[model samples]
Structures are given as C-alpha cells and as structure tokens.
Target chain A: MGQNYLASLSHYVPELLACLTMFGLILIEATYKEEEKGRGFFFLSAYLGLGSVMTFSFFSLSKPAVTIFTNSLVIDPFSSIMKVIMVLGTLLAVYITSQSKDIEGNLKPEFVIMATGVLVGGMLLSSANNMLVLFIGIETLSILSYVLASLRKGDDRSSEAGLKYSLYGGISSGIMLFGMSHIFGVLGTINFTEMAAALKGVETAQLAILMPSFLLFLVGLGYKIACVPFHMWAPDVYEGSPLPVTAFFSIVPKVAGLAALIRISHNFFAVEGALNIGWVGVLSIIGALTMTVGNVSAIGQRSVKRMLAYSSISHAGMMLMGVLVISELGTRSVIFYSLTYLFMTMAAFMVVSFVNDKYGNDHFERFNGLIFRYPLMSIALAVVMFSLAGIPPFSGFVAKFHIFTALLTKKYYVLAIIAGLNSVVALYYYLKIVRLMVLKDAESKDTIGGFNILNQSVVVALTVPVVLLGVFWEKLLLMADGAKIFIQ
Target chain B: MISLSSYLFISFTLFIAGIAVMIARKNIIAMMLGIELILNSAALNFAAYSRFVNNNLEGHLMSLFIIVIAAAEAAVGLAIVIRFFQIKETIHIDDAAQLQS
Candidate 1:
C-alpha cells in the first residue's frame, strides 16, 4: 500500500509542486502589506521554484509510460516534455507580465496565481487519459483564461474579451460533451486505451455517429487552438487582454490542446482499418482554410496584437498539417515546431508589450522609426520578426521546414503546396512590421527614448533562443524525437 | 416502456433548441442559458445511454460531473456578464464591439 502511494505521488510530482507553490504564493500575498515591494521577490521565487521543479521532474521521471491513479492520467515522455515546456512558457509569461504596465501593484500577485492555476490545468490536460480528466482540465484552463482576460479590471475591452471568451468556451465545451456522450454510448468506456480496443471492431452503422462524434470533439480542441470556424474569438480576445495573457493564450493552451488532439487522434483515428472515419480529409481541409483565412485577414489588421493573433491561427494551421500525417516524423516535427514557436512568439509579444508600454498604443504607427531610438530593442524585434517570417538562419524557418518536409514525406503534396504559399503571405505582414520599425522613419521624435533596460534584457534573452535554436536545432529535435512514442 | 430512441429524440431536440437560442439570443445571460440547455441535453443523453445502451453507471457518473462543470461554467459566465453589464450599462453583446478590428 505504501509503495502504491509513493508511486502515485511520484507520478504527479510536478503538478503537486505547482499546487504547493500556488498555495504558498497565496499565503505570502495574504500576509504582505499593500505597498510592499517584496511581493515581486516572492513571485519571482515562486516562478523559479515551479520552473525548477518541472525541469527536475522532466529529467528524473524518464521511466516508460505508466498509468496511475486508476488510469485517469498517464505519465510518459511526451507528457513530461510537454509539461516542462508549459512550465517554462508560464515563467516567460510571468516575467513579461512583471514588466508590463497594464498589470500593476497588488494585481501582479493575483495575475501570477491565476497564471499558475492555468499552468496546472495545462499540465493536467497534457497527461489526461480519461475523458472526465480531459474535460476537467480543459474547463480549468478555460475558466482561468476567462478571468485572466478580464484582469485589466476597469478596461471595457478586457471585460468584453472575457465575456466573449466564456460564451465561446462554454458553447464549444457543451458540444464536446455531447459528442463525448455519443462516444460513450457507442464504446461504453471513457478510458482512451480501452476505447481504442473497442473501436477496432466498430461496425459501419456506428461509423455514422462516430464521425460526427469526432468532428464535435474537434470543436472543443479547435477552439482551444484557435483554428478556423472556431477562431473568431481569438483576435478580439488577444487584442483586449493584457499583453502577457495574450502571449500565454497564444502558446500554452494551443500546445496543450495539440497534445490532447494528438492523444485522441492516436487512440481513435490512427488505428487503420478499425475505424475509417476520414478525419484526415476533414483536418486537411480545415488546415487549408485556417492558414488561408489567417494570412488573408492578417493583411488588413491595424493592431499589431490582432495581426499576431491571426498569424498564430495560421501557425496552428501549419501545425495541423504536421498532425494530419500521423507518423513518428510528423509528431516530432509538431513537437519541435511548438518548442521553437515558444521562443519566437514570446519574443515578439515581449517587444509588443514593451512598445505598448512605452508608446501607449500597439498600432503600426507607434512602431515606425523604432529602430532609430532603441537600437538594441529594434534589432531584437527585427530578429524575432525575421524568425517569425520563417526566414533562413532562424528558428521559425527550421520549424516550418520540418513541418513541410513531414507533409511531403507523407505525400501530402497539396497540403505542402498550400503551406508553402501561406508562408509567402505570412512573410509579407511580418516584414511590414520590420519595415515600420527599420526602413520607415519615425513620424514624431517626441516618443523617442532610451530602451528600458529590463525590457531590453528580456527581449534579448528571448531572441537568443530564437537564433540559437535555428543554428543548433538538432538538440531540440532529438529531444522531440524522444517524445514521439505515444501509442505504445 | 420507453425505448432508447425516444430519449435520444428528446435529447436531440434539447440540443437543437440550445443551439438555436445560442445563435439567436443577443443578451449574454440568455445566451448563457442556451449553453446550459446544451450541457443538460448532453447530460441527459449520457444518463439515457447509460441506462439503455451501456447498461452501466459510467454515463450517470459523467452526467453528474457534467452538472458540476455546467454549474461552474454558469457561475463564471454570469460573473463575466455582470462585469460587462456594469461596465457598459447594457447586456447586449452587440454594444461590446469596441475591440473589433
């Protein structure tokens, strides 16, 4: 009995550590004086402690896949790496928030606490093996995100963003639950492994219900990842939320959502001749539409945040292409792409948040002639932009190249072509930001000032990875490859 | 005795009604009610399926969980709606379009 208890505890070490840190932070916040400056130190310690625990867990828990806690959660290499990524991403986001002008004073601690809560949900999501666990994880993540979106308190836009996010999230999750009911009716089980086993002999008549079940399931996951048809809420939400929350919304949930999708797809759809649901065809079409819509609409956005929102949608589409292939190589590419994407996206949004804080707005005009005043920041932003555009000698290019090569390897030639074309369209808007910053002169010199050392340091720190990952991607790719054994 | 299809038909009607209300309603609270309807329909389906098809308690358990989740969602949704109403003095979603591109 003691051995069993110990094993379960070890299985959830990282999540337990995060939960403890969150409670500790709450206690500290409760005790601190209203005007205390030491709160920042506590927040920093909480993030560092959480990050270190996740990193430690990632290296130490390298055992083969095992189902614990009555098989509701699975601990494996894939989830381990994804959990580490989510934790590190949360740390980066908290750092950016600490530097943002939007969230100030006592709100900072609340923000960190809520962000940590979301990270816990994400961790749950990446490892969930049961439908109930998955649903709970998604809702936990969604509820926290709604609160985070409206964290700007007095801002009308932020409140509206929160409302819209909740409405959309509520409806989609409802639909997903309905789908789950049908799936449960058909399979009589919620455990993924058992469901996969039962699905092997499903009749053709059952396929009718199963197909819609699959699509309905996609609705929830698609909304989380902000893919098309379900992506309408993304731009408004991203535009309205505090910058760090927007950054968090873009990367962490999307990665976790993709992880859930991978789990579902591997268990249900990857079994050839068991259930021929044609999910690949549907996902491929969605991928095509998602990228097209994302890139096309991005061209007209005046707000840089909204443009990044659309770009993220397009990137989701590209990642979907990786998912469609359903091979070890394809999975590795998606994982690797997500890792590289973490750095590029955080760097870009960090620059945006800094610009917004300094200039008071995130419009393209504010970015104009930015290179003249803050040379270091501008260069960092330039590197980030070039990488985001998937230019050579940068991480984004390598990520995209991996995705495209994966598609081609699967003989998804048409998807590869659509993705290739979308890259060109994506390049135009990314470079437009670069042009505004570098080529065009600032319309007014009044806004010129030296870069904030803290902001500049953060931007530089994030950009280094974007460049380093591009040059030495093999290390990350090797790690990603290690995470590909999902179906065993 | 009622058949499985009858329960499914009722659940389907509930689901459709929920979707229609969600699409048609302009008031955020009303839309939230629509979401509740959708979730309850799903819960009903789970209960019915467990009783009639699976012959097990899993679906009933799922419905119970769904109830809890729907309550939590409603709580958060209503809070956001209240916050929005306080800010704009109106509950219509159309007026909250200040962030549009």
Candidate 2:
C-alpha cells in the first residue's frame, strides 16, 4: 500500500496540483465577495504559475523528473523551457482577467480553474513520452478550453461556439485514439521510442497501415494547430469567446499542441529523407496552404476579432515551417519563434481587448484614429504587427530567418522561397489593421474613453520583447542554439 | 473463447454504430453519446490487440490511459452541453446552427 501510494503521488503531482487549485478556487468563489473574486482567482493562477516554474527548474536541474511516475513522463530541458512559456502565457492571461472590470465585476472562479487546468495539461504534454499520456494531456487542455471559450454565458453565439469546439475536439480525439489503437496493433507498443523501433522491423507490405495511422494522427493534431482543412471551427470560436480567453486560446495552446506534434514526429517517426519524404511533402504543402489561406481570409473580415482569428490560423502555418524540417535547428527555431509569437500576440490582443472595452465594439471603423487617441497602445499594436509581418529589428523577422536558414540547410529551397514570398504577402494584411488605427480617423467618439491601466501594462509588457528582440536578439539566439542540442 | 475475428467484429460494429449515430442523431446529447461509444470501441481495440500480440504491458497500459482520457472528455463535454442547454433551452443541434455558413 505504501509503494502504491508513493507511485501514484509521484506521477500525479501536476494533475493533483491542477485538481487542488481548482477545488480551492471553487471554495473561494463561494466564500469570497464578488468584487474580490478576481483577486482570489489571480492568487490561484499565481500558485499554478509557481508550480510550473518549480517543475521546470526541477526537470532541468534535478533527477526528480527521471524517477517520476514509473517513467511514464520525462522531464527535460525541452519540457522545462516549454513549461516556462506555458506559465508566462497563462499568468499573463490571468492577469488580463484579474484587471478586467467587466469580468471581475461578476466573476466566476472557473476562469482561474480552467486556465490552470489548461496550463498544467500543456506542461505535461510537452514531456509526454507515452502516447496515452499525450492523449490525456491534450484532452485535458481541450476540455478546459471548451469551457473557457464558452464562458460568457447567456450569449447565444458564445454557447454555439462552445458546441462547435466540443464536436470538433471530440471527433479529433476519437480519431487520435483510434490511431493509437492501430499503432499498438502494428507495433505492440505504446511508448513512442519503442514503437518507432518496432515499426521499423515490419515488412513493407505490413507497413501499409502506417499511412492511415499517421494520417489520422496528423488530423487529430492538425485540428489543434488550426491548419487549413481542419480549421473549420476557429473563426466562430474566436469571435464568440471573451477577449482575454480568446487571446489565451490563440497563443498558448498552439505552442503546446505543436510542440507535441513535433515531438511525435521526431521521436516516434525518425526522419529519414530516404524513407519519409512523403510526410515532409505533406507537411510543407499544408504549411503553404495554411499561411496563404489564413492571410487572404483575414483581409476580408470586417470584425477585428474574426480577423485576428484568421491571422492566428496563418501563424500556425508559419510555425509549421520549422516542423517540416524537424532537426535540432528546426526545433530550436520553433521554440524561439513560438516564444516570440506568444508575447507579440498577447501584446496585439491586449490592444484589441482594450479597444473593445473602451469602444464597446469590434468593428474595423471604430479603430480609426486609434493611434491619434491611444498612442502608446497603438504603438504596441504596431510593434506586434510589424514583428508578425517579419519586419526587421523585431523578433518575428529573426524567428522566420532561423526557420528559413534551417530549411535552406536541409536543402528545402522551394519551401524557403514560398515562405519568403508569403511573408511579403502577409505584410499587407497585418498592415491593414495598423492602417485603420493610424491612417484613418474615427467618425464617432467612444463613450468610455481614456487609457486603462491594465491595457497600458499589457502593451508595455508586449512591446519590450519585440524591441529587445530587434536589438539584442543574439543573446536569445545563442540560448536557442544551445537548446537545439537537446531537441535532437 | 472469443475468436480474433469476432473480437474485431465486435469492435467494428461499435465503431460503425457510433458513426451512424453521430450522423443521424438530432439531439446533441445523443451525438455525444455516439462519440463516447466510438471512443470505447477504440479503447477495446487497444486491449484486444495487446492481448493478441505479445501480451506485453504496453498495450494494456495504453488501454488504461485511453479509458482515463475518455472519461475526462465526457465530463467536460457533458458540462458544455448542460451550459448550452441552459442558454438555448433546446438540445437539438439543428436549432443551434448559429455558426453554419
């Protein structure tokens, strides 16, 4: 009984932390006053943030990760770095929530609870060595996100968005689980590294199952990344979700989900150019389509929220550029780029949320004279926009440069050219939003006016990195290169 | 003893039944139930293949994991469904087509 209890306790700490924090939050919600609920929520989010930081540090420096959970999960430098990303993104999101007068006024603790659950799940996913654990992590994140997405209750559109998320998520998980079963049937193993070796020994005729299995796995993962053909659910969900939650949805999950995708492909399916050119080709094509479609579709949307939704889709495509190569350099590029993307995205959405709060709307016309009125906020949004558009002196340009260099090193010249051209095309649309805020002036005045402190901090927080990346990128570049060593 | 084909056949029927219900059911609850059925069938496959193959711990452990995830999904999914019904007061998916283009 002692041994059994120890085993469960060791492996389940993160999940248990998730459960405890959630329980504490529920208790707090009932006992705390309405105006003070956001404070309690922030405290809970900070607790999870501390838990993540500790786990990451332990995974990096100690042998604790090695002995945890009977070796079901591995905690390594890669997982540690990704954990920090998840933690930062989640903490900022909770901060954004805590500061919102709208949300805190009648707040529910479930917001904090769900955010922590998603963060814990994402951190676990980064280091999931077993396929089953991967599924668990993914579903936990998705389940919590579904609630977060629909949290602005009593709105018909919001509920509809939640329903869409469930159906898409449910189907994707079902497919992924089926694929796992097939993989077990073929290789007789669920561990990713072991399964790779087992599948290698199978005869050519027998490996036919490999294609279907991989296809299903890709679809399951693809939905999370919001790649084209699987991105049917993103726009509605983004538009309907409350602003901070949408911001969280757009940035954090993509990082963890794609990190898992890269892990599966790297660990389970060894990249042999001689054998797996097909997977590379499939990924490259999808990457190309995702970027082009996301960029083009974004241009046509009148609603700023919906436009950002499409922009997020395209960024997924941009991130996949690194995944197609799947080298140490590629992985490092992905990590660095995702880190850069996270802050820039948060910054951009911070401005958007602030604007939405002040103007009481999300239409493009309302954004006119935004720069004239809210200079600091507009500048922050511009910084993110320029960075996203791959303008120099910003980290987005540096991130894309690393990917292009990696692809070139891999001799993927055509893909390199396509990404380059796409960035140029992407520039136009991102600039359109920038244009509305500066080039055109608003026809009508906003009722609730003035720069809110929370948004001011959000913009300041967001702008620091983009400008720093533009100036002192080499420091992070070196760290990225060092991290690349572990990815292989 | 159940033959390998019979076990596979049972899995197939469950999979097919889930697909049918997902396509035909009008109520969101019924559709989600179909999804649960499909996930169970898939989990059974993990167990079945594990038994038939090398009788190793990998397959069984995987099946256990699948069961855990399926339950998590169901709980959250049901919660969402309840939340949706509270707003719309209807369970039929067709009536909830605000997002269809």
TM-scores for all candidates: the values are 0.96, 0.91
Cα lDDT, all candidates: 0.86, 0.77
Highest-TM-score candidate: 1
The reply for model 1, stretches above 4 Å from the true place, is A1-6, A274-277, A443-450, A479-487
Please write out the lDDT profile of model 2 over residues B1-101, one tens digit for every residue: 78666777888788889878888989998999888887888888888887886588777777787778778778878887888888888999887778653
lDDT of 2 at A146: 90
Which residue pairs overlap in candidate 1's backbone? none
Write candidate 1's Cα lDDT for A1-488 as tens digits: 67876778877888888888888888878888866765667776777777776776577445788888878898888787778778878888888877777676668888888888898899899899989899999999999899999888888999999999999999999999999999999989888889989988889899889889878988998999889989989988988898888888989899999888877877778866634338888889888999999999999988798788889899999899888887767777787788888888888888888778877778988899988878888898889889988999999999999998989887889999999999999999999998888888887776533256766787799899999999999876665455444444
A381 Cα displacement, candidate 2 (Å): 1.3
Model 2 chain A worst lDDT run, 10 consecutive residues = A58-67
Error of 1 at A232 (Å): 1.2
